[model samples]
Target: MSAAPEVKSADANDRANAISTIVLGFAADPMARWAWSDPSEYLRIMPRFVNAFGGRAFEYGTAYVTEGARAAALWLPPGVEPDEAEMDAIMEESLRPEIAGDIGAIMKGMAEHHPLEPHWYLPLIAADPTWIGQGLGTLLMKHALRRCDEEGIAAYLESSNPRNISLYERHGFKIVGRIQSGSSPVVTPMLRPAS
Candidate 1:
């Protein structure tokens, strides 16, 4: 039997490609839709947000980018989730002042639901818009989950876009909880036990 094609683990050298993939991939995501109501503002602020988000993943945990930047995934390894200060920094750097308070509450709500047990956290994962339905997402998910299995750690993620829940379900994730704060987008938290 042959192994799956490898998705490259991103490093400092892959920063630009990985950031671009994340921004393009998540531009229309539910959270983005709720936060950046203006298309022009979304275009301007999303890249900064993704850069900060993916940059943390790249620096502290595992970041993967498929060939041609079609897909990307950010996984924070067990015990590597960012601290309060880091989260505050991320919000400050990525979000606009007008939307900051609301997004911060959403972030806090999401964080409160995170599993206390050690696990791998997937904060961002996406396939480029042009590459959707082409299996790039599956490739990245499988690759990262395999690593989690090897390390004997559970996997966790919050699906901001309901459309992608089935995709995560297919990869062994089950909804553990749901988060909805006022006007914020509904977030479904999923967990996949270590195999």
Candidate 2:
């Protein structure tokens, strides 16, 4: 077997490539497509959405990428969070009226399922379509979860694609609840207790 890909903390120089990988990885994601059904819209808005939702991981040195930037995971450490205001603005300006109306319920559902205590939140994790069969996802997960385990802090994430649920479960995440807003795909909120 070949050597496993290395997972490293992504720096500012890696920001564009890392975000582009995630954008490509999530191109067909149900939740993402539901919000931006138009191909043109998805292309235009996804990068901004990624930035608004998980860009802080880069600043905090928690964003991870595998070799060739084929996979990425953005983990927001305790006390850190997505830029809610920017996210709100992005959705407001981009989503269709029908989709925009559901944003409130979707946000409420996410908040309700989110852990109240301090924990690491994985807002996004994905592998480029070209590299889906490789072990990059598992590699990235282990790299970040090691830090969470060492810190004795819990980790959480919402599975936007059902195909990825098994991968998260294999990494010790358990589905706590489901979040589904009007005309939106099911989002599974999962948590991995502190080890």
Candidate 3:
């Protein structure tokens, strides 16, 4: 396949944009968004996630920075290849009460019960609000999907709201579960096979 546009890899320069994209994505729902609403907190927690997840966390992201103007983004970590049991345990452990109040407790509980293997959660993805409907989200998603597909892997993520769920469905993700965050357990969780 012809290569996609020359997108930039997530780096220090892109951290602010990346963090902003993440916040906006989560901001769709007030409760779940609070976890990382603060930019400084987002930075602190991201590295901790990377350390725990063996880089499955988005210490770096893929972005079509030029055309989309920071529209396309996905915070996915690398290393330790995706594994199911380990991921739930990791996600559950990370969600412990020590992590955050009600949010952590709920996620930790869900992780213990979560059934899936090697699920690669997007955690966050958002095109510039003004840039939606122009395929920027797909552009970024395809980049990661293609990479994961090459490894014959499947992935997963939970959208902050139903509207975004459609965007994910249109992009080939399937609704695997419905997540009602403890503070506000209304968001839907979805999954997709890498393509």
Candidate 4:
């Protein structure tokens, strides 16, 4: 694989690029596809959905992107998880009310596996679909994992794509639990303890 791209802390100038990168990179993701079913529909609502959940990561936590904004990773510091009311509002507004129950049940089931102890969280990470397997994701993950190690903090995430599980596992994350409610795509929650 080519060397990982240079990693930089995202600035205000990078927010829009970062968000666009997420929507585009995740366009074919299993969970995303499951939620929207139709490609056009998924493209339409993905931004609002990403903004609702991943916006806080940029505002209150940390966001990292490669040169040219080709890839990105959004990390949340301990205690910075989204507010329940805000998330609920976003879902109600951005998603069809029909899928609300399924969404709710999926989230609730996923939450059951979260570690109670303080930890950093990775809600989303993506390379432009064109850049996958070039090691950008690994570089971005190491940048954040280094900080987690410095603070002796654990890290957590729910992997929506089975294909990425091994990549995360290579970084020391272990699958702790799985949630599969109704016809929703499986979400595997993973945790990596402080090294």
CA lDDT of each prediction against the hidden true structure: 0.80, 0.93, 0.55, 0.85
- Say which prediction, candidate 3 or candidate 4, comes out ahead on lDDT: 4
TM-score of 1: 0.86
Q: Model 1: per-residue lDDT, tens digit, 1-195?
A: 955456988888887787777778778788877877678777777666666554577886488988877788988887775455654665676565777877777787788878888999888898879888888899999898988899898999999999999999999999988777667788999999878
The candidate that achieves the highest lDDT relative to the unseen native structure: 2
Candidate 2's C-alpha lDDT?
0.93
Candidate 4 runs further than 4 Å off: 1-4, 94-98
Instruction: Using TM-score, rank the candidates from best to worst.
Output: 2, 4, 1, 3
TM-score for each predicted model, relative to the true structure: 0.86, 0.98, 0.63, 0.92
For residue 142, give model 2's deviation from the true position in Å. 0.5
User: What's the CA error at residue 180 for candidate 2, in Å?
Assistant: 0.6
Candidate 3: residue pairs that collide: 83-118, 84-117, 84-118, 180-185, 181-185
Ranking by lDDT: 2, 4, 1, 3
Each model's total of backbone clashes: 0, 0, 5, 0
- Candidate 1: where are CA atoms >4 Å away? 1-5, 83-101
Candidate 1 residue pairs that clash:
none
Q: Can you write out model 2's per-residue Cα lDDT over 76-147, one digit (the tens) per residue?
A: 999898999999999989988987767778888898988998899999998899999888999999999999
* lDDT for predicted candidate 1 compared with the true structure: 0.80
